[model samples]
Target: MIQDRYSLAFRLYPYARSADQDATDPVRHPVVIMGGGPVGVALALDLGLQGIPVVVLDDHEGIGQGSRAICFSKRTLEICDRYGAAGPMLDKGIAWTLGKVFHDDRKVFEFNLLPEDGHRFPAFINLQQPWFEKFLIDRVRQAQAEGAPIALRGRNRVDAVAPRDDHVLLDITTPEGPYRIAADWLIGCDGASSPLRGMLGLGFVGEVFKDSFLIADIRMKADFPTERWFWFEPWFKSGASTLLHRQPDDIWRVDFQIGWDVDRAEELKEDNIRRRLDAMLGDGVGYDIVWSSIYTFQCRRMERFRHGRVLFAGDAAHQVSPFGARGANSGLQDVDNLGWKLGMVIRGRAPEALLDSYHEERAHGADENILHSTRATDFITPKTPISHVFRNAVLDLAERHAFARPLVNSGRLSVPCSYDGLSLTGVDGLGGPDRTRPGSPCPDAPLGDGFLLPRLGGDFVILAIDAEAPETMTQDGVTARRLAVSAAQDPSGALAARYLGAAPGAVYLIRPDQHVVARWAQYDETALRAALRRACAKE
Candidate 1:
């Protein structure tokens, strides 16, 4: 009956009787992820690819209606590439690098997200949320066919959760009947209104903006270029602000800031919504409303992301305004950060304390995202007349003055969160490029005919560039293999410029997630071992 809520796009995992249903004791899993959304599915895929047995539970069978999240950043694609899930997205998505901002009828300025490129992926891609989830699910299926230990259980709703000392008990309900299961590690990727969080008696604390925005995904044949266009107090006279982006299948996403006080039911009505669209798209333009929803901006996150053996990820752990396209993108980053550490701990290759770094690092990321989201919401929805005046002046000056352009924040799009100076980050002895500093996500560079990222695999790597390093090094059972490359390997000179800069030679201690843990001008076995231990939380 809950399926009535969603217009199912793909019946990925329908309810089926399982052996666990007839078990006398509760079925146990190494890791159980509740909620089969992008985050949960991606995490499962990542873990399964790492040969970790992961089970994903979802109340629904498949992706629901609506183009909920449409923008994915370059970093997201890179992470998916490691899991072999980015190819389909890149092929189907509409890539865009240019973004234009407007105030009233005049254009304020335009910016290119990726000006200088020698990278594999684009700045960002506009793809439907359903398609994104479907791609991830497909990858999961492919991974499964390749003998990965992963399971996707649909219509398996968790009615209750009992947190034990070493494991968590989950009471699940299905159409067939009720069943109980236990997990050594329980992950709550159940989303913003997380049922698991409620059962655990936890809450998110932060501000929710009063203003609301209506999102309408429509099918139109207009010639709008594949670029991000945002307007403030538009000439169309539809709403206070507007955003437009193009997705696949001729679908266009239109968002209108319709103010704080409005009739919720009346605003969603087809005719009423179309009237606003008519004003913006002109009288003759035609389009069909595919989906619609109204949402208020919220900048909030849980006090802590980890609770004993139960870990919260994605929207379950933190949430921010959707203006920056941070929701799904950040969730993928959470999987990237947590997947490796959790795998290492489960395999007994690292201390259990290593799991704490997931919270430490991702909480730092969540705070940064919330800060940006809050600032954008305040600027987009000014509370006072003086603030509005200041905003307008900044917009006016941005049109002509280059310095003022940075103040015009339609939404500061997504970027990878740096873990510099964080708990797990090791020494940064090399005076190399700041972009390649310790705790930074390794920037992609062309290596021969291929790229550098794909070669890093999902394990510790010692990237030696024109520097001497041993073939391999290990500490506390975690081994790091050397990836020796010289300036000659790259014809474009991007690899050297990005990794070495002015330094003649450099070496980097890279984490499994392809983040630089430490770097040195020259390789030293003792320092490498210590850095590896620090990265795995052994030191």
Candidate 2:
């Protein structure tokens, strides 16, 4: 019999005789996430908050070294806050307000993300990925300390994943032994060359840039502003591109272009790499190289995010060039999109069909991001003769035309993606479309006593204007509140138009993920109830 009560064997077979007996048994969890990267960890944390049990497995001993993605947008920070992970991240991260784009030595364009918003948080934060991972790990540990049935298995590699009609099974091997885990759902966040995606016969189809870039993390002694990210085109004597960002520990991340013609093995030498860094920083400045690697840029996305009971997320589902910093940010959004829907289905609140929207919505967003990042890469480092000429022309035009600056910067950064044509987001009316129409993210508004946006709990929100005598509508287990509104009292014109159209009273139901599920101009209890039922049931 198992002596330890909390051992895997004991958990799998409480009355098991030995390891051999437990091997014949199956370990089950509501959700099983493969890969312990940020996306996988975020999903686990989010689900754990929802009182769901999750098992996360990864092959690495701990968070990997080097700075991969160091930028976090306000939207992502909001999601992290929902799980109570934002405070520590904010304290440890560097909040950046400015970013500049340059060509040769001349500044072409610049943007300041800070604006007049009631939000207490900054618009963007930059932190080393290793430290960021540690922050998340700490959060996960704290939640587990509070009795969440979440488990993390490091140094464990997933050998195979098999999806059946009812459940998905994962075969994972550790130093101890091979184990079988049966889960209601399997999320593959295993990076670009995902074995799970391959096992499911899913193919990622898109373009791969022939050029390669070198990334280096080094400690610098120069007097450079630590608050902004700098990009250089036709950089250094070799005329390759370069990028620089500040990290928390006085360390800086630099990306230098290594032409495809360079020998990968010989070019990565410590001396050669140090020489390039010295040249970039000038001879007087002393620095120590922390890490370095060569990576090829690709813009590919999985044809389908969902394959039976197995779903792909993060880099496993799609990949974009590093130019726009969309790769990690997009993956975080993928988990955000799927986390709640998975909870709804697993908890029997919504039908399985609701999960289909994951592929439909995220694939579109992934394609759009890929296009954006690809354009940014081409603009920064023109590979072809035609592109080289066009890049120079655009740079010259941007110098004279203020309108051209925004266009050039559009593809170089992150923007909130929308699901305009999604079946779940509802129809766009024929009238003047409100900027915050159905299917778009709910805009932030100030409440009498504090900010209203951050106060929205993780569940779907029903914003009814009337404080007293607000009518309640329930459908298919989904509920909504109807409020009486006056045109004169409407603070946000967009919200008023979205819910009430031209009417004075209206009802709007928002999803847990912040997309509008349904809206009505006039509140009719019966009709509103039916809409709620259909949306909640998601037939």
TM-score of each: 0.99, 0.88
| Model 2 misplacement above 4 A | 1-23, 227-235, 409-411, 427-434, 466-472, 480-507, 520-527, 530-534, 537-539
Q: Residue 331 deviation, candidate 2, in Å?
A: 1.0
Clashing pairs in 2: 475-533, 476-533
| Candidate 2: tens digits of C-alpha lDDT, residues 314-379 | 999999988777888888888888988898889887888888888988998898899889888777
| Top lDDT hit | 1
By TM-score, who's the top model here? 1
Model 1 clash pairs?
none
Question: What are the Cα lDDT values of the candidates?
Answer: 0.92, 0.71
In candidate 1, how many Å is residue 282 off? 1.0
Global fold similarity of model 1 (TM-score) = 0.99
Write candidate 1's Cα lDDT for 1-539 as tens digits.
34445678789999888889999999899999999999999999999999999999999988887789999999999999999999999999999999999999999999999987678899899999999999999999999999999999999999899999989999998988899999999999999989999999998878979999999999999999998999999999888999999999999999999998999999999998999999999999989999999998578888888899999999999999998889999999999999999999999999878898999999999999998887888888898999999999999999989999999888889998889898789998897888999999999998888889888989999999999999998787888999998878888899999999888999999998889999999988889889999999888
Candidate 1: list runs displaced more than 4 Å: 1-4
lDDT of 1 at 502: 88
